[model samples]
Target: MFARRRPCRRPSPDLRCRPSGRATFAAFAVAVTLLPSLAQAQCGGSFSGFVRGLKDEALAAGYGAATVNSFFNGAAQDPKVLKADRAQGVFQKPFVEFSRRLISNDRIQRGARKSQELNKVFHRIETTYGIDRGVLLAFWAFETDYGAFQGDFNTRNALLTLAHDCRRPDLFRPQVFSALELYARGGFDPARTTGAWAGEIGMVQMLPGDILENGVDADGDGKVSLKTSAPDALMSAAKMLSHLGWQPNQPWLQEVTIPADLDLEETGLLHRKSVADWQADGVRAKSGSFALRKGPAALILPQGHKGPAFIAYPNFDVYFEWNQSFTYVLTAAYFATRLEGASVYDAGRPDAGLSGGEMKQLQKKLQARGHDVGKVDGILGAKTRLAVQKEQARLGLPADAWPTPALLKRL
Candidate 1:
């Protein structure tokens, strides 16, 4: 089993790890050119070349040869897809800023309206899937801003590029095959299979494999169309969440106040703990209420000791499992609040986020300082923050895992 790391205690500083310098870019360019040859040797031929392999596997898995071949015949490597994949601005901004951009007023308002408009559909989905309608609406908003910007990138092309790229072959190769399976099932025409640069499809931008596994035709049109059908998309998303272990009628997260002397190391909800157990340790609702009556929740310090604290439930982790980004999950929860007619987060605290270039530089510096900051990828995950904390402790700085201009100067 893959070991899950703890969530970030605080919002990541602007200067987390990023991809190495231009040399790395040049190397990537070379790798992309050689990817097809490498893939042919490993799994044989290009994506189309893998057809026979897929056929054998599909037959073993109870699929017919005609079904497998029909799907693979339409699969081809798309150069524009590869170009977009290479052009991604990974680790381009701080998590806080990224979250802010995604959880905008337009998204909130649209989500609220969409929630109201789709009340019956939402209720039916909730009843059938055990996932809340507001949460589903929030996901819809967060992913594509209520379909205002469902990407036009051809998903088959993107998946082919990634599968050929080899850096993450283990992850993407299966997805490529799954997309073929989806095509064979007539979920969507291969010509119209478009989505994000990474091949996530529809309003919620689900991966092809995910769609194949969890998609539902809620409208009963005899088709599962995530692009044109809001009901189908929303129900499919709720089903995905339910499969991911979403608990019905449970809070995803709650703003909370932690005691001044609480141990940061002991802050996570790895094991189930009662709300009363947390209140006994002086944790209180952010609403300033002492009444500690609620369901099980795990404490999350998104910005360590200084930033906002939250009592995140298992449902919150369900959101994280969707994207594996702390900020992404937070934005989903915040958007859900707006769908439920709650106020937006008050920006009383002032912390300017870092730009894309600054984040890249910081990640390089952290890696140079001997921290196991993975890949210098601009996104700050738990590994990157732990590395930052180690360096901060060494420099006698606050081990809060927040990056600052002063820290950059020190580097």
Candidate 2:
């Protein structure tokens, strides 16, 4: 297995590495059209043609032709990256498994130490940005394991491959141009620059477009180097989140207890009701009560009724800008809670969900029976939850809204 990376809101930049013998995909970049020595050499066919087209687009966008061609020349297809592009995981592990791997004892310990060591920086960011330090730390650790292992792919090469592969060209194309745009502004070189497979760069794994638009010069050296500067990366991340409407001091979520007899329809994020409404619904606050955020919240049964339940709030939407997965956001929130000195989930997670492949099969079965669970991407999401609930009700099983092998067999 390879270390997991992010997939952003727009196919924009969920790029990262894969562990298969020959699997990897990363993307989006900028211009390349120098003094036109060999337009014939640079503009051939296949990905080469695509690269030339990208160059023209960049030039039309006001980038220097010399800058564009310098980056585009000798850009060849990366089959490994293409293989990785096609191999995006269709199934997802359960919250329990996913959380365990993402936030282990060692990770928690590191977070604690980082919080202690980076107090001034975190404090500065929070005081200025009104964001929680713990949440920022979670983003940092999750993105590159605290910058321990950012990928080494040539971002331009990776973006080049993804852009030409014909799999979501609309998404990767802009990203490639953005990366080139970033290079045009200087400091970034196509050869020296590298990052996640999808061309995500920096400690916080901000996409190139995001970096260009939202990156901060936290270090104030007159240059923004997310790959090398911590202050710059962290501050940039906080700024991006703030721009995305991160509620200052509002909890991303809180662990809670749902009564066994509670109405199932009231659960899920869409049924957002105030805390008082949830209290009326018999949801008990197992975690510390939300003193500041007392209003609108939604009950999220990430691992179902048997596992830990959380009350998510508006600020939780910021997590979507980082990743679209519910489990990932929950994991990040839980990790931040731990960094803030909170205990592990009192309810703990259940070990009953189906594995990735099993979930994919279950998704297929559900699709066969006519439940549109979206791309059948096995990481059971909202549509899958509704589908599972419908199936459970149809089979006269309790609509717990979680996947299980037994349920699959019954289907």
Candidate 3:
């Protein structure tokens, strides 16, 4: 999730979540005017045509005419959703800055208070799903500040707009149908339900498909009220993470100290080695015990060799399934550790990172050199990092993937 302005926190991702925080209605209305032309172009002509097809599909899928009609009744193209989709480049911030911005003393204290207030709920989630409260709490804090603002976008419009958009129709289109199914089940309201711009519902910002699959009525309310029920939100998140293959009672991330001469090639998400092997290579835990010392782990130099390093375990991989942004995942995972009483990371003196403009230039250079860094969006994404590592190695620099001003100047 990316940062937001005022009252709200941030918007969460969809199945592989993207950021969609709150925006002002004045801004939302302005964005709407800029949408219709692009909407027509992208949705294959007038939005009505797309709605007609959706209605037909719903009817064919066996929903009654009234239900289908009502679901699509007032659905309109929301340009802001598309805007949020494209604006997710904010996740480009390096781990240290991003984490520092998000992990405030207020959030950490609030997370602790929430944990205590919901002790029974947390205990139930842990016992039932084998997931720790910190994971849920961290997400809860990030995705709407523990339910303070679960987005103000109209859920129906947000889903339809994304479904009609060209960029990721496949992901959002199916979610529309899933919302239909939830609506049919007496759970969703076409006009009333609202959350993240990406159509994620509730405090934890789950996609419609996830809600359909993992929703839990933890408070014995007979209905999974994620918006109003803390127990429901936390438990549903735990169940979803469990479904996402979260290893129970396992550590996801741990800050570590690496010897100066450590083989930089062995450090990265792709290169997994046993913890013992890493220890032999002089990667020692910064604090606390390793829950699974023999587990397979990757040495992640998030800001290259000079910045904070972490040993990411298998559970860390599961964060990608929740949100694909490497920086967001690392920050969230690290925050989870912080909520569980881990010490703050020791941020080493990493070289100054590239400006957004410089980063896009670097990405362009990497692409010209035949390395695929996805979009030249100024974000130091995974593919870009890999390309950076290759270039650094070729240039006789440390193969740590962190991009810096010096590297940019050299290139």
Candidate 4:
């Protein structure tokens, strides 16, 4: 009776519609509806916690907390960063042919104009870095399409993602930490930190560790910004070249005619030989000039037996240190030549680009016959070609060592 009287006397709008238990149940339903968002937030928070642990390690490495927080506070890991770390494809054409696609007429013209415009700074850089202006300009053109497409992905996020992904952890993890240190020092703003999917930043696409070590204030404004300042980026790249042992006054690579009927197997790993020695073997410069008299050079046949070859020098190896891909380094050298008004390559090579599946099958067949084809990775390198040659010799084929669908069928 007391309960009924109380309810009748004190029923308010807030309590009239539902009992306390019902109200509590409705609130629980709303919370259930928002559970997915809450879980997502929790996951993000866990990632942030990992970042904080990294930040503490960075501070122990002598970075300021403020700097660490600025870089990592809102940094989300990007999954696509691993795409850049995978090994690249094998091209059917030699580097000379590859370069023709990179150093187009339009690119050459723009490079020439840019070179002329930046002549003063170029001269200064050349004097200071002992690197040729044309070489640097060529790199600028090749790396970012003359700064037209330097990528728009967040650099920190990409680095962090790659570092966490164990495929290349040892290489990328330190880089991620180093980038954090750089950001902590006010070296660059987080918002301004953007680059390729693999964390290569700016016009030159240099990694963060490179920025920390080789970055220079070429503009004399007391900061290194690869994003906007051409001089800084170019100078930094030139400095990196110098560090990588770019010899002065040495030709990077030169086109050479391979002697007919020479045993390709006898060439054996492309050892460095004197120009005189190469001349004795019937390898001659395309221009009929033996200008590279000083250093040793190696013969590189990018497309096996039926493509243009080059006598690449020590400096050519240095280009490989910048980017490991033979195609990339060759393109860089070719672009440099175009910027200097040199003729494009005329490698009379044939197209033989195998699809990924085809290459895998070819590798498998070679392995089945017991040749060290090295992991069936769908890339045709020296090892793969050697395996093919061994298989061809076994089958009493022509032994040219080139892979084809016909060869696959026989296998």
Scored by lDDT, the top model is: 3
Error of 3 at 309 (Å): 0.7
Give per-residue lDDT, candidate 1, residue 225.
Answer: 88
Q: Which candidate, 1 or 4, has the higher TM-score?
A: 4
Q: Distance (Å) between predicted and true CA of 288, model 2?
A: 3.1
Candidate 4 segments whose C-alpha is farther than 4 A from its true place: 1-53, 83-97, 266-270, 349-353, 365-376, 381-411
For candidate 1, the lDDT comes to 0.63
TM-score of each: 0.76, 0.86, 0.89, 0.78
Give me the overall lDDT of model 4. 0.65
Model 3 lDDT per residue over 9-35, tens place: 111122232212231222322332354
Give the per-residue lDDT of model 1 (tens digit) for 51-146: 555455445444456655665565667777667655545335444465576667766667667878888898898778777667887777766778
- With candidate 4 superimposed using the best TM-score fit, by how many Å does residue 329's alpha carbon deviate from the native? 1.8
- RMSD values, in order shown: 10.2, 7.4, 8.2, 18.4
Q: Which residues of candidate 3, in runs, are more than 4 Å off?
A: 1-43
> Between which residue pairs do clashes occur in model 4?
67-184
Residue 304's lDDT within candidate 2 is 74
- The per-prediction tally of clashing pairs is 15, 23, 5, 1
* Model 1, residue 113: C-alpha shift (Å): 2.1
Winner of 1 and 2 under lDDT:
2
Model 3 RMSD to the real structure? 8.2
Badly placed stretches (over 4 Å) of model 1 are 1-69, 87-91, 258-274, 277-282, 288-296, 348-370, 393-396, 408-411
What is the full ranking by TM-score, best candidate first?
Answer: 3, 2, 4, 1
